[model samples]
Target: MSTVFDIEQKQDSAERLLAVADKEPRYILFADEFNKVARKTVESAIHNIELDFSWSKFKNQKQYNVNGIKQVHLLRMQMKESWILDAADEVWLLIDRYKPKRTIGTSGKLKSSGFKHAIYPDPDNPKRPSEILITGKDMILDFGQAFYFKYFSDDAHTAIGYGNKNLYQNRSWVYLRFRLKVRKGDKTYYSNSKGVIEMLVKNDYPIGKTLDYKLV
Candidate 1:
């Protein structure tokens, strides 16, 4: 589970929550109900879950207010789930669907050290030969923050600059992206930290989804 709220993503949808408060007064009730439900869901999930460090451990993390409530529920966001807190009289889902764009042919070398921090060697693929994952420089900047990757690679990086040659010299890095498409009236960008947007995994893909892709 993520320790922090994706400020970028939260900020994107925050304006929506704020702007309609005055006009749609019931929206406040909707938000409060949503928060209450989220808090209960998270509290129950935390109580049942057996993690080394429990989510309840963050109870006193200088976060909750005197009323003993988080400004925004963490568990729902951490679980990548979003509920429609308030719907207009004529509610219409501005459902924005996105899928990963498999990008290949881009190339970069692995970091000399500390790659282990980002590269999570999959224990399930124990017998598979390890490949040094060469990704774009900033591609993994948010590895530990947003999502944990299951790297099938190892610490052995190839020397591709000038002298030594390795079979990986010809290999390129592969990553995924959501093909960008801004809605007609969407002024706020879709991000986790700032927007009130929901980022979720696409489960209905034709190819089988990997088990490791499950989030908390």
Candidate 2:
């Protein structure tokens, strides 16, 4: 085990490296690599759903309110328009595949994504079970899935389906979630962009600590 002094020194060095990475354009390149992986992950998840997709079954379900949060704008799936609901269910299923068994006292009462991931109550909407509990490696998949859902709802161009010539053509929706953006009196830093890139480079890249950090 390392001593406290050594741990502190390592943390300080990491902080310094992160600070320097913020100014470099190569961070963007790293972010690009991460984004590519994200895209493939999302695509793979979508592909799995499509393999057995039953557009006909979706056509039978009545119109339903799919919105999980009341605070967010309300979204409803109109009659015979189950595409959004299908996609959302797929997201829930992916989360279920990796989450641990249901917590004690919560079994059988909670709704499941059908993949066995128990749905938890949403603090934002008590009546709607939208909150999903996840940790560790699954979080990245969650982000990508959530990103895809958000964009797909906003713009059908991102919809994953056969016969759409423009399918995945405009993938800016995927990249947008990782981009840094600023508004009047407010700025948001997206961690999956630079922060994750730094961590991946440090831990997974062969260059290790000797790698030259720069932004393109």
Candidate 3:
């Protein structure tokens, strides 16, 4: 039996719970802070109970309101296992279908250091390996605000960014367009947006479905 920590895989599983909610049809949200033991307990409960629904990891704190409440129920466990997994598979598939374009990253090192400041011992030989030092630079690409079918509307969109930075900073924002079509019983029910795009790349949601997301 896999523990909650094993399934959730993060410092706080609460954010993952919310990310799961964002893609769900009911639009409910779940939030909680769990240590390793607590997370394992929840995970065991989820697996043993055999609840139905999808889940995602959360990345930010500003999105969740965890002042007084301890646990949150984001989605009703009603779907069958096959259905849940199928939906997740679809979401993953869609993400694979629309892979984001690679842009330059933003972190770098000095291309050349003066001879007097060289770190290597053999600075006299121009042809020596110490004569030239290899350096690198990175750029930040911002992929701004993504929208989900269940909660996001025309005006509001979830913002996301990518680059080499710590948890607190280094994410850039960019714009994305939806190419796929989602219809329910002859009516167009869902469409991918920028939020979905970022979630797909950053959060690792299943194809064809949405889930709650938070940054920690």
Candidate 4:
């Protein structure tokens, strides 16, 4: 009978060793350590931009009219294409796995007319029954299935609750707001590049605080 204390001690030792190994300095490094840090900082900023855009696209689905909003534009050319392709691949993979009989959006927007599938249980009608519900697993499966249906169809319209451009722009604003909140004590001095690097140094590499904080 191994005691619980022994098990805990073993786990703790393993974790410490792993952390030490991860931090071990490597020789013959392809890039200078400082250069690596600078590169990673740029990569993270690009990722944040992509995430901001994705969140915006999700929000646009909720708006009734999207014509008034400025068309979503990608400022960084190379990063923009990479983000779109990665997003499309993720959606494609999800669609392949779930294989939903029919897909519907939040506002009762149906993906296909002839396809037959049961709706998730309605909260208002507690007695109603279906194969799907609003749990986390079901949501994941639904996204995968929905992606496939839309990608394959010639007349596939945007999924419900996410088609409006304004929704995405508002989403981008919200993402920027929260990021600034986490990075800076005051919102007035939030520059996407510098703020993020400062936050990372504060949280991850405190020793690197003396380094000049710049994206490139």
TM-score of 3: 0.15
> Which tens-of-lDDT digit does each residue in 84-151 have in candidate 2?
23333222222222122233364556433222222454354344232322221112211222212222
Clashing pairs in 2: 24-215, 25-215, 25-216, 26-214, 26-215, 26-216
Tens digits of lDDT, candidate 4, 64-108: 112222222211111222332322212111000112234465677
Worst 10 residues of 1 by lDDT: 84-93
Query: Which pairs clash inside model 4?
Result: 56-168, 60-164, 61-161, 61-162, 61-163, 62-161, 94-144, 95-144
Predicted model with the maximum lDDT: 3
lDDT of 2 at 67: 24
Among these predictions, the greatest TM-score belongs to 2
**TM-score between model 1 and native:** 0.15
- Which is the better candidate, 1 or 2, if ranked by lDDT? 2
Reference-based lDDT, each prediction: 0.24, 0.25, 0.26, 0.23
lDDT of 1 by residue, 1-216 (tens): 331121122222577767775675654545556555644443343233221212233322222221211121122112122221111111111112222223334655333421111112546433221222212111111111112122223322222121122223222121222111111122221221111223221222232211112122
lDDT of 3 by residue, 1-216 (tens): 332223443343666666665586456323333344554454333233222222332122222222211222131122222232322212111111122334445544333311122223334423222111111111111111122111122222223222322112212223222222222222222222212222321222232122332321
List where candidate 3 sits over 4 angstroms from the true fold: 1-73, 81-100, 106-158, 162-216
Off-target runs (Cα >4 Å) in candidate 4 are: 1-31, 50-147, 150-216
